[model samples]
Target: MDDNDEDNERFVRLLRQVFRFLHLVLHVLAGVFLTAILVGLQRRATDPSYRSLKRWWLHRVVKIIGGQVSVYGEPAPVGSLLASNHVSWLDIPLLGGQTELTFLSKSEVKDWPVLGWLAAKSGTLFIERGKRDGAKGASECIAKRLEQQERVLMFPEGTTSDNKNTLPFHARLFAAAVTAQAPIQPVAIHYLNMQGQTHPLVPYLTPQTLMQNLWAILAEPKILIEVHFLASIDSQSVPRKALATYTEQQIRLALRLNSA
Candidate 1:
């Protein structure tokens, strides 16, 4: 291509990125305001109306961020536990938009700006990651919620990764499913750019602050997220460790990765 043509293409791309970034900022601000209003309502956390509003807000955020989600299978029932691979911060809204489940997040997230406040208002469960008995306590809490017929979503990887592979699953949280006799549903999440290839920018890995990751995602012209819900395993039939291993294997196979 000619020099002028190349320069013009670059300029156009820059303009698009700026537009997307602006759009994301506007939507986030609006979401924050709406979340404040929801918090003022003083509805119980498990109220259906509360969850519906949160889900609607998440749908708007996903749209503004230019993410297109494609689901391959149906999500498990409300009383089940959803174990999914960790990809990005976007995973929260992506799954939230699709279902009314409460997420299990690190306690530190309660201190993050805007998003943390919204999460707290939405009744997200926070666990202290480094505490000696944190997982056991969190598992008991999850089991009680399951007994109440509330679905819970957890990322057993304990951290995020690039979308190319699955990390080892931590088995402690699986104890909740066994205790509650809830089915364990394994979910695989993958992110791709407009070209249908995995995009390195989507994963919120080490050394990348949330803002940097957010900007990188906003700059992408298009991001396609695929969520695959594999078959549900009966939690009562197997021990927590075996259940965790089986769930992890299902998710890996769904993502086309080897069971390592």
Candidate 2:
């Protein structure tokens, strides 16, 4: 590319980022009004009166972030355990917005600037990432939610991966479904660009600051995330280990991502 071309691209990205950033700030400010206050950090996430507020609030956040969610296949019935492949931090809001279900999140997310406050206000269950020691406690918490007839989604991969890879599923999480006897709904999430290929800018990877990835998403003019809900599995019948493997295969197949 010529020097002028590179300069123009930079200018465009800067302009886009500024415009979107202003909109985001205004949206956050809007949270003060009563209607918006319903989505406040103090609101009860599981309150029946505001059941859809969390989902609606999430949809707006994803929209502002330039993510357009497209769903394929039906989401499993309410109270089913939704299992999906992890991709980006955006996955939380993107997936949660479309499905009226609570999901597990990184414990640290509650401390993120604005998004942290938002996630904490939603029906989110927090877990410390990569601590096997906490797995049992996390699973037990998830089981309790499931037993309460709440739809709880979890990323069995336990961590995010680049679009080219699908990490092996951690069987420990599937135990939640077994304990609760809830059905497992396998979900596949894909971030596709305008060309329908995996979006290079959206994946969350090490060494890349979250601010950098967030800027890239905001600067882009278009975004598409496909959420495919696969067939439901009977957690009651299969052992958690088998349940984890099968659910992972379903998500990998739906995303059409080759194993690394």
Candidate 3:
């Protein structure tokens, strides 16, 4: 192509990015405002109606952000525990859009600006990492949610990683599934660009603030997300550590990564 053609193409791409960014900001603000109203009417944290609203709002957010999600397998029953790999902050909206599940997030997320408020309203369970009894409390909370027939989604990696590979699963949260006799559902998440290759812009890695990540995503034309729900394991049949290992292996294999 000639220089003029290249310059014209770049200009068009820049215009698209600007439009996407504005759409995202407006859509997110509207969704959050409506969600806050619904949250006020929610009688309890686990109310089904409130969860449905959250799902609707999340779906809208995903669409506004130019995300297209494709699911491979069915999610486990309503009360099961979903163990997934952490790839990006977008994982929450991607999964939550299709499932009625509460997320297990780090306690620090409770301090984030708009996201923290939305997460809290959506019944997210925050874990205070590095605290002496944090895991114990989080485990008990997960068990209670499972026992009550609510699906709880936790990223056992304990932190986000590049979408290229799987990380080691933390065993603490698995104890909840075992204690509650809940089935463990393994999920693998991958982000791709318009060409269908793994996308590097999605991961919320260190030194990148939420605003920076949001801008990066909005600047992209499209993001394709794939979610695979692998076979469910009976928590009653294995110890917590074993359960964690088994689930991680299942997700790793699904993502085509070598098992650790």
The most accurate candidate by TM-score is 1
Which sections of candidate 1 miss by over 4 Å? 1-3
Q: What is candidate 3's lDDT per residue for 92-183, written digit by digit as tens? A: 98998888888999999999888788788778999999999999999999999999899999999999989988878889889999889999
Estimate, for each residue in 111-151, the C-alpha lDDT of model 2 and write its tens digit.
98766766666667889776876888889999999888888
User: Tens digit of lDDT per residue, candidate 1, span 1-260?
Assistant: 99999998778767777887787778778878876776688677687778888888788777877889899999899999999999888888898899888899999999998878878888889999999999999999999999999989999999997899978999999999999999999999999888898888999999999888887777677789899988999988788889989888998888888778
Q: All models: lDDT?
A: 0.88, 0.82, 0.88
The residue ranges of model 3 lying beyond 4 angstroms of the native Cα positions read none
Q: Give the TM-score of each candidate.
A: 0.94, 0.90, 0.94
Q: Residue 205's C-alpha lDDT in candidate 2?
A: 86
Model 2, residue 45: C-alpha shift (Å): 1.5
Q: Candidate 1: TM-score?
A: 0.94
TM-score, predicted candidate 2 vs. hidden true structure: 0.90
* Ten-residue region with minimum lDDT total, candidate 3: 39-48
